[model samples]
Each structure stands twice: as C-alpha cells, then as structure tokens.
Target: MIEYDSYGRMKYDPQLHFNQGKTWVDEDIDYLIHWLEIIGYEEMSLALGRTEATVRDKVFKLRKKGLMKEGDKSKRHRKLLGRCKDEQAVNY
Candidate 1:
C-alpha cells in the first residue's frame, strides 16, 4: 500500500521504490550496522530504508570488521522473527 498524505492524497514517494543492488555510502552503512547490533534485521532495515538482506549483509560486514559477534546458527533463538520486511519494500 502507498502512503496517504494528510489530505488523503496518495503521493508517490521515491523512497518506496526499492532500488535493489544499490550502492550505499559508508556513513549510512556504519550507522545502520551499529544499530543492527542492538536491533533485529527487519526493524533495522526499515530504519535504514533498505532490505532485510541489506541489513544482514551489513551485519555480516560488521562481523568481518570485528564489530559484531559471529555465529547465528539457530532461528529458534532469533529475536523479532515475527516482524517482516515492510510492505513498501515488498511492493517493489
């Protein structure tokens, strides 16, 4: 679903368009990766306007940089698995 303006107009927001395989700057990546340590992937994706895979990739990069811990073997212990990637990202 699209976003409805205050007056109820559905304006086409450019951000809703999921630019897959897009390149990101280090600033956005670093900030998101920092939060990724504290938040789940899906929520972090929403906050950073990226896909869950993008957030995962960021986390993986953090692991490579020694910023985050390695080892996520079980979804059984995963946090916030109930939440999903935002509908806007899915719409793309």
Candidate 2:
C-alpha cells in the first residue's frame, strides 16, 4: 500500500523503499552502474529499491568520480525499443 502527502504526492515509505538512507554496498553500486546505462531512472530506482532522487544523486556522484559516462537518454530509449543488442546481462 502507498501513502500520500496532503498535496497528493506519494509519501516516502520505509517499507516500500527499504534501502533509503542506507549505505550503498559495492555490489549494489556495480549493479546500479550496469543497469543505469541501459535503463531509465525510474526503472533503475524500482530495480534497486531506491527512490528516483537517490538514484539520480548516486549517478551524479559516480559521474563525478569518472566511474560512469553521461547518460544518453536516446541510447536508453533505443535499448528499450529493442534496437540495441544486450551487451551485458542484467544481474538485478
């Protein structure tokens, strides 16, 4: 079940987003990097059990560290459309 704020926006729920505010493990980071290149933020968030904001923030940090390239929305869109080959298997 989901709860909403007074403004009708979804409220943050610990039960739904259990990893919120938790330290990211190395495995999680690896998974995030791999999937991030192929999926959009919302899909990545749901797969990682994290909020979209948190996922975006982490992606920012990873890019800052030279760990990831700038995400190309068009590339991801192509992948979603099955136009690109699945180069890597999705672990999560």
Candidate 3:
C-alpha cells in the first residue's frame, strides 16, 4: 500500500522499503524505466509502488551503475526496451 502526505507527495512507507533492492525481474525494471521516461516521476512512483524519491534514487543508481544512460534519449529507450524484450523472450 502507499501512503501520501497532505501535499499529495508519496510518503516513505516502511512496508515498501523491502521492495527495494529485492531484484525485480528485468521486465519489471524495464517497464519502470519506460514509464518514468514517458509519464515522469510522480506516475512512475505510483507504478513502482514506491515514493517519488525512491523512483528518482533507483533511476540514479541505475545510471551510476551504467545500466542506464544519463541523457541520451535513444540509448535510454533502447536499453530499457531491450531489457523488457529480453525478459519477455526468456520468460522471466
């Protein structure tokens, strides 16, 4: 479940913390990055069942680890889509 502050920003829900670093299937992570790119942070948070900060943090971490490109739109889209497609192919 999600908790929201009075200002409507997603609040850090302790219950959701366990979902972090828990190893999403590649399709899930790809879907996350794709949604973040298309719809932006707030909606991404909803889709990810995470706080907006967590969404931003995860994306940043992915970039830091070189799993995602920082600013190259085409590269980002390809990487993200490729991840999803790979997962689908492998039935993961």
Q: Which rank order by TM-score, best down to worst?
A: 2, 3, 1
Residue pairs clashing, model 1: none
Per-residue alpha-carbon lDDT of candidate 3 for residues 2-92, written as tens digits (9 for 90 to 100) = 4445544556655544465456668767977666667766656656666767777788988888887665455332221122322322111
* Poorly placed runs, candidate 1 (over 4 Å): 1-19, 71-92
- Global lDDT of model 3: 0.59
Summarize candidate 2's per-residue lDDT along 1-92 as a digit string, tens digits: 45433433333557556788889999989999888777776567667777767888899999999998887756633222121133222221
Kindly give the stretch of ten consecutive residues in candidate 1 with the minimal lDDT sum: 83-92
**Evaluation by lDDT, superior candidate among 1 and 3:** 3
- True lDDT of residue 35, candidate 1: 61
Query: Candidate 1: TM-score?
Result: 0.48
Pairs of residues clashing in candidate 3? none
Preferred candidate (lDDT higher): 2 or 3: 2
Q: Which window of ten consecutive residues has the lowest lDDT sum in model 3?
A: 77-86
Return model 3's CA RMSD, one decimal. Answer: 12.7
